[model samples]
Target: MPSMTEPKLISGNANPTLARSIARRMTMHRGINTNLVDARVERFNDQEIFVEVYENVRGEDMFVIQPTSNPANDNLMELLIMADALRRSSAARVTAVIPYFGYARQDRRTKARTPITAKLVANMMVEAGIERVLTLDLHAAQIQGFFDIPVDNLYASPVFALDIRHAFAGRLDEVMVVSPDVGGVARARDLAQRIGVPLSIVDKRREKPGEIAEMTVIGDVTDKVCIIVDDICDTAGTLCKAAETLMNAGAKEVHSYITHGVLSGPAVGRITNSVMKSLVISDSIEPTAAVRDAPNIRIVPTAPMFAQAILNIWNGTSVSSLFDAETLGPIYEGMYSSQ
Candidate 1:
């Protein structure tokens, strides 16, 4: 039986900084010396991933922090292997903490003969003996149905709402939340509601993969500063084109707050040269050198929210309360009040 104590945190090579940050927050929140379980993840000569848990995890609750980001295959394999190792080590329960769920964009098939890799990933995790899953802002909410075990899909809206409030405290009236595409209107509308702003949508057509055909602003954005919101920003093509269209529609400025900054391809270059006033993304995926060097890019740390979620899950408390913007508003306001 597992002891009624703090959960053991093990980190993969995917994003150690985020893991460490979560550990630190856990320690502070519990007022105890919470430390990461020592583990070595190395590669063989042939580049096969190897994970060895150094400490005894028998009868302990283990939470492995690994984001399936860049080199998605490698990180995902590491997570699967680590879960297997922990299960074999007699861990009572294993929770896979995947901050950025890779391959989630393929939750459904747009055409025939397409594979739902998201469901495949979920099956792999279950087969690897993951008792639960903790992730942030899944590309599709329905992806939760892919897993049989408990899955907590944490949202970044609370975090983004706080940042948006701080950045435009006195002039929120001039702000408008925009969904870069019609599909993201719900996500953008949530943020807009939280921040008490009107919502707008960008009607876009994609001619091919990773390319935008046309973008048109759906709602009135005249003279208002637009803040485009979405779950992920991959190539930056859509975001850039939307910003341009919004500008042409008489918007004063365009900014963006995305949950996952999967800034792949020419994303950094596009954002740097685009007309966006600022682009803020959560550090769900570890920022690359190019991302960090981008002048218009800012990364919001997600450790605090993830840390709280982990703590809640371990304690068998309700994690849904964490998503309550009303409750989180005052807390975040106090947190950034001095900054």
Candidate 2:
């Protein structure tokens, strides 16, 4: 752990709003004494990313906040080049704080000839002079092993649980937490336990990429408020299909709560036409304008938990409590005073 004064937060063009939100949660103000050096991220005729940090950062413990969201290559290269520049400037330490890690879905190889892009990204960060990393709700937790340095994987379950608690309040019992697939059962289970509700699973089969076949739902959801929980909502196909299945099976109402909202393709339109009553997602990734203006979609901030985690890391405090099942709410006081 590093000292409070040693850490300095920086930002890139990717999701500046989330970075600002995290900063506000950290300092309890709109802006901190941090610097976002003006860098014109451009490419040559050969299509190569170029970055030049305008401000000096000699011997400072720097953290570059950038989510590898849309325009993945551009944002990713920006983070990499920023780290390299900071390294060249003699920074004491560099930590890449990526709220939304892109290409995390390719953590493993399912075919004979395939690239483990997630591990490749980890290698890229390490080679770019990033000594440590901070990320949230990785598609696969084992991806942490891909990195040689310290990789802190934060959980968004606590944040989502609090939101669900407040949003439904007395109607929580009627809610049934639904995991869209078997891979997400653990995540949904955690949320169900926190909100004290029964759990259900959508046993679906992926016939091909970007498509899903909703076979049958396990457990009871009839006449119950259904809540689908997952780490990411990319394309929103599985979620929409699952909601339709739940609705067709006599579910009273259907909703969704996902950590990352990667609303690509026709996801927005699909979600609009789906049987889901509402879709709740966190601001880990920047949503498109259509996603932002969607009537049924809402974004909850993950800034408070992240800001507290940063403070704890700075103060050399225990972050284990953040994952404790019993304490599923953001830690107040201590480092979370502003929250």
Candidate 3:
């Protein structure tokens, strides 16, 4: 429903496949014919970023698709420069369609003398002439408040719900939704409510930012099919530990559904050796070679939901219906509710 008169699509080097898929769904024309200029960024001898945009976007409502995933700093700078360039070209509005918004985990100051990098990223977007933001499942939902412009924080749980329902049709009564850590209890609870299952939480302690100390599960997972729901899975420590804990607690099967797969360091190997049956992740962050090669790692597409959201936003309609449990079709409601 984007205004056919002045809409334009642009993308950076990051996740061009997703951008192209979104463009295809929007135009129904096998992707829009927008140019993707090579942002030849380099260090200025002093290790500073230099960016340049090669396309003209005058009077257009431009949507720049860029995921700040791996090499996040470079991708973030590229997106900022694209926004700035579009604004300079007299674009009507610039939308930063970042599937993965980096620095979101640092939304607040958990310790003394730590900078709130998420707020800093928001400020940079504002300064770079970004009129709006479209991101999927930020680590901290509060990060949406950092932006001055309207931000759409999309959820991947609904999509996951559909797949889960289809994959585990008659086994709903044996399913249990779990949070990998205590802090993610709210997210898991929301998913469990929508899926109509019992909710459980993994009581975990983090000794360091990228380290997991101990994991103790709170709810009864005995002989139950467990599904761990989390916003992001980086390093895979927390997820692996939680899976191990659930198995130790007598879980019959363990599956993980993470929004962003930031699989870093030994994540793939850890998941390979862990007790999790499958690790389902969204296409918000581009999959790595290791993730693609892992037999247990499965990917669910978010393009349909994102495309529908773009349609809703363009037509100035309500997007709240997307999160409603009833509207997600009867197959999911019956399957998940019984579980």
Local distance difference test, per candidate? 0.91, 0.83, 0.81
lDDT, candidate 2, residue 172?
Answer: 83
Error of 2 at 83 (Å): 0.7
TM-score of each: 0.97, 0.91, 0.89
- Distance (Å) between predicted and true CA of 72, model 2? 1.4
User: In terms of lDDT, which candidate is stronger, 1 or 2?
Assistant: 1
Clashes of each: 0, 0, 0
* lDDT of model 1 at position 98: 98
**For model 1, the run of ten residues with the poorest summed lDDT:** 330-339
lDDT of 1: 0.91
- CA shift at 278, candidate 1, in angstroms? 0.5
Q: lDDT per residue, candidate 1, 1-339, as tens digits?
A: 324856989999999999999999888777987799999999999999998999999999899999999999999999999999999999999999999999999999889999999999999999999999999999999999999999999999988888888888888999999999888988998999988999999998888977778888888999999999999999988899999999999999999999999999989999999999899999899999999999999998888788888988888888898897665554343656733
* Model 2 misplaced regions, further than 4 Å: 1-4, 29-47, 324-339
- The global Cα lDDT (0 to 1) of model 3 is 0.81
Candidate 3 residues lying further than 4 Å off, grouped into runs, are 1-4, 29-55, 325-339
In candidate 1, which residue pairs get closer than 3 Å at backbone N, Cα or C atoms, i.e. clash? Answer: none
Better of 2 and 3 by lDDT: 2
Clashing pairs in 2: none
